[model samples]
Target: MMKTPRSFDHIDTWVFDLDNTLYPHHVNLWQQVDARIGAFVSNWLKVSPADARKIQKDYYLRYGTTMRGMMTEHGVRADDYLAYVHEIDHSPLEPNPAMGAAITGLRGRKLILTNGSTDHAGKVLERLGLTSHFEAVFDIIAAELEPKPAPQTYQKFLKRHDVDPASAAMFEDLARNLVVPHQIGMTTVLVVPDGSQEVVREDWELEGRDASHVDCVTDDLTGFLQGLGAKS
Candidate 1:
């Protein structure tokens, strides 16, 4: 059995990952982004779809994010990569009233902590009608081009916000991205994607431990927040 941390007694700041964690992955927004990324890799590298997929997966495995791998291996600029990859149609992401209520329900200062660019984060939050939900959106650009899963980036965030690590709760969709925050003493909640049968991914297990640091793992964000005593 995984050891659960003590109930988050000290938390007063809630940091959320904007993409898959804020909205259900079934919304398929990321599916569109993935297709775009695959196409970009195929066209840019002059590779077939299979090869592009392989490269993308391999890079994501080696580096915490594909952009990091791209920069290290192909001299890709961070700004250009973010601009190209996040250019998705926002029409599909209609404002989710339930999500908005859940955000309003949660206590304390809310912030978006994502590996995405701030402009992309703004667009997403705007589309989801969540622009007012957060006090700030800390994007990858804020980290001096470093992405999540990097200890320095999280450290930098804490310093920038003047946040006490022990008083923050980080809710993230990707398990790999939660490792550093967990290590740094934040209450970590894994927003398990809806409809996923597997409790833990093999890659995340190999990259870190087997979800032991996670305080709670749930698919229903609204319900989970309610369970935590959030009031709408």
Candidate 2:
């Protein structure tokens, strides 16, 4: 593993996305939540399952989150939407001891910044054996139902925790989500799959993977975190 850049040494707070960023994409844990999202949309809109997926993706693209779009256009209750979509089986996810060790090794206030609910983040963290590492979970409710890539949501997060963006690092699986963090002067790391995972993502979400805003990219997040401890 390559030594992590010295720029990350100043980061006193570590912020991470919870979904694929925490666990491997191959685990298919999110696929269940995704299906439930579609199911919620279907039930709410009285549309077929096939049609619901289309609407879900469209809303996700139009707004930062489908929940936000649903609330705006359909008067859908935010809490209800979050509760319904997150009722998935998390048994498929396996714990990553290496990643858990790496996270425990990092010297900083670790935080979970997710578009999902705190309940969902909590469950996934427990599944991955990482529930104790993070100090806080900032979920959709905390964001006022506005997800990441929205500058205001990030501002809210930083303000809520008294975090300085320059002294923080943000890790995420989607390149688009890193744009706001990068622009706000935080070190941005894009965590990707190792080509072995069968992950699903929208075309736009993959667009800026190599863009200037992305300071680093790694398929192995645990290795990347471990590399940060290596001698320069």
lDDT of each: 0.79, 0.87
For model 1, how does the per-residue alpha-carbon lDDT over 63-93 read when each residue is reduced to its tens digit?
7677888889888888778889999997877
Estimate the Cα RMSD of every predicted model relative to the unseen true structure. 3.0, 2.9
Clashing pairs in 1: none
Query: What 10-residue stretch in candidate 2 is worst by lDDT?
Result: 1-10
Candidate 2 pairs with clashing backbones? none
Could you tally the backbone clashes for each prediction? 0, 0
Largest TM-score belongs to which candidate?
2
Q: Write the per-residue lDDT of candidate 2 for residues 1-232, one digit (tens) a residue.
A: 4434327878889999999898887786888888888999999999999999999999998898888889999999998988898998999988888998888778888998999988998889898888989999998889988888799999999999999999999999889899899888899999887889577877676666667888999889999998875522
Error of 1 at 112 (Å): 0.8
